[model samples]
Target: MTEQQQEETTADQLFATIGEQADNESYDENKVVNEIESLCMNCEENGTTKLLLTVIPFFKEVILMSFECPHCGLKNSEIQSAGQIQEKACRYKLRVNSKTDMDRQIVKSEYCVSKFPELDLEIPAQRGQLTTVEGLLGNVLEDIAIGQDVRQTEQPEAYQRIQDFIEKGKKMIEGDAFPFTIIVDDISGNSWIEPKPADAQNVWSRVEYLRSPAQNARLNLGNPEAPNVDDIQPDEVHTFPASCPSCARPCDTHMKLVDIPHFKEVIIMSTACDDCGYKSNEVKTGGQIPPKGRKITLKVDDADDLALDILKSESCALTVPELALDLHPGTLGGRFTTIEGLLAQVYDELYGRVYSGNNDSREPEENKKWETFLGNLTLAREGKKDFTLILDDPLAGSYLQNPYAPDDNPNMTSEEYERTEEQNEDWGLNDMVTSGYEEDETPAVIEAPDFPAGAPAA
Candidate 1:
């Protein structure tokens, strides 16, 4: 029989024994425990007996019970030594196999906490989120509006604890509401939108960081510390707040690079409102970069004469490259340590776009000069970042909108999709078994024993 069947058999035995004992004598925890062990051990080894006994919880007399999965992880969150528990965690003693008195005491207490899910517990359900904002704190302008974070980047650990807290507080989820992001105004009038990969292929050698003290500082972080991979910047950057047409929400948009099934490489741009929960992700495929002969336009949206005037003005407009290199990079305001570091440094700080906010909204003509200087900007070159996008047109996304309204977003989500379409379809329709089904074959009609011809009717 299966595990479930074994559990059912064990439950039946326990109840029968309990009933028999009650009829003879009185309640006894020791006797009950002994009976449980005796009957449970003898139960069929199949899963049937093991899986069936949970129903005993509803019995008023069954105050305590124990179960052990043959194979399962222990002390799930982290490993702690007996020494540490003694010093720091009075309640977190280890589960040891010494069979000594101290070991038995520790195991008993720990098992009591673990088995009784209703009791107090200690574990950080959520850990290891980002530690810094870095060079990514700009005002995203989408469709001329601002944007914010509406949902907490879904960390399953956080929500699990949150569920525990809610359970303890006796709060009911009247409706589904999970907000994650925070939306804010474009106070700085600046923002960068781009894709951030959870893990990247490149790493800065120690020598590389030392070459440019300034660049090292940016990658290093707000507070100087030992350099690590986590310190590196992203490959692409974008400005936000025009409003993602799909979600109809506004905020600075950035993408966390994730693998798209079947597709080679693609970047997903997203903007989530902090207040009203709304978000949109625009997946831009890794397209072939135009050859060097391709004609690129710089849509300054300003007049040619005005560009000359600005150059001649007391404060000339800084080139996009200069703006990206010198003024950008780092977590917020550190410095660049190398001339050729990450692509973000090359674009946002050195060769980045710069606008006086007075340029014509249609200055695609001004790009002629930069286009000539850079030559046929062959985008598909090998050294270029893969599965990423480089969009300079600030006006390319004017019509984008947020898809959902506020109060609808979930706070956390699983990194992977839980159920596929096929599984969901099966949910509403269970096994096609018919209720109270009768055998289709006609029951054989037992011929009445032939009565003797001369037999009298009684």
Candidate 2:
């Protein structure tokens, strides 16, 4: 029998056992069939593993299954609904204000997406794991601890910041903070934060519709004909053309729309040049127009600041003014990366340019300047020195997280301004043709270069 079938059989047998016990003695809650011999999936050994199944009847009937292979020490568990699949997705929002909230149970399915906005943190869905609110905090702490160790070696200042976050999380678990919110988006509708008892007063929790089109698409619940790739039509795809930056050969670029979890719309564009086998990738906003041009600036006072998330549009220009760093549009496109990762990229590129073999003949003074800049940048990343990060986007699609936002974060500020006439011209916004041809008119078409063999037709 299949593993699932075997699980059902086990549950049925356990139910029968529970029923037999009811006749002999008074029934008790938490009916469990533990230590049952089972084949080890990991080692492919027979009867070397133990399976534990518990029946939990709360608001709904739930089955908790756990198994462990003593030979390989592999353990697995899952919480499954005895009822039919939920017709709609579920979202659980918890306003954590006291230690009691931390004691609540959290059942996270493999498809649950957890977001902690206060910490500017998000944990993408994975395998189902049963944990309490406090245990969830512990899991986040464990992950940060591992990250801290790596940062300790590569980014000492960021390591110190992570250590501080861990300490703060510990205190928060003990009910130090007044209020924080944790949101769980479960596309499968199998996850939940335990509800407070009816007798409990002033508890904060709620359920709501996910209402995200992208999320519904991810769950494949929006279309009954989904999971069939053949149903896709030609009109659904978007394509454009551009010259390869390396070879200057005509290349076809394809744009695919994607959504960033708990964020805005994005388009991933990919193109490859058959002539030189050069590939290019870039991200752009999904045709969003900000009301006005924006300039965002942030002060990096410590390594903890590096955890900030940035969404830089393709038209955005970024720089570290303190280091005389300037990155304009066309130099680099849009991206979503942590502040620390962006700095590391800058450091690697500069290091290569200064110390590479081709640059060995550079003047001594220039070499000294490059070395000093590198050292200073390192110090700034470690929080030993302070620096300012500025993002200027004429398109106004860039964003930097403000930790104290809606309450005014003192270290960061954002401003909007009108674009200049010259700026509008440069972006081709002012050069549009207002005239349109008649319906019967067909403009002359220019012939495109022959695509390489086996390429999709244009």
Which predicted model would earn the best TM-score? 2
- What are the TM-scores, per candidate, against the unseen true structure? 0.14, 0.40
Q: What overall lDDT goes with each candidate model?
A: 0.24, 0.63
Clash tally for model 1: 85
- lDDT, candidate 2, 342-436, per-residue tens: 77666775565345323333457756776787887787766788899999888887778777756877889889999987656545555443356
Instruction: Please report how far candidate 1 places residue 354 from its true position, in Å.
Output: 18
lDDT of 1 by residue, 91-178 (tens): 1111111112111111111211121122232222121111111101111112112111221245556645545544532321121221
Worst 10 residues of 1 by lDDT: 199-208
Q: Pick the candidate with the highest lDDT.
A: 2
Give the residue spans of candidate 2 off by over 4 A. Answer: 1-31, 34-58, 197-203, 210-458
Clashes in model 2: which pairs? none
Tell me how many clashing residue pairs each candidate has: 85, 0
Task: State the lDDT at 260 in candidate 1.
Answer: 36
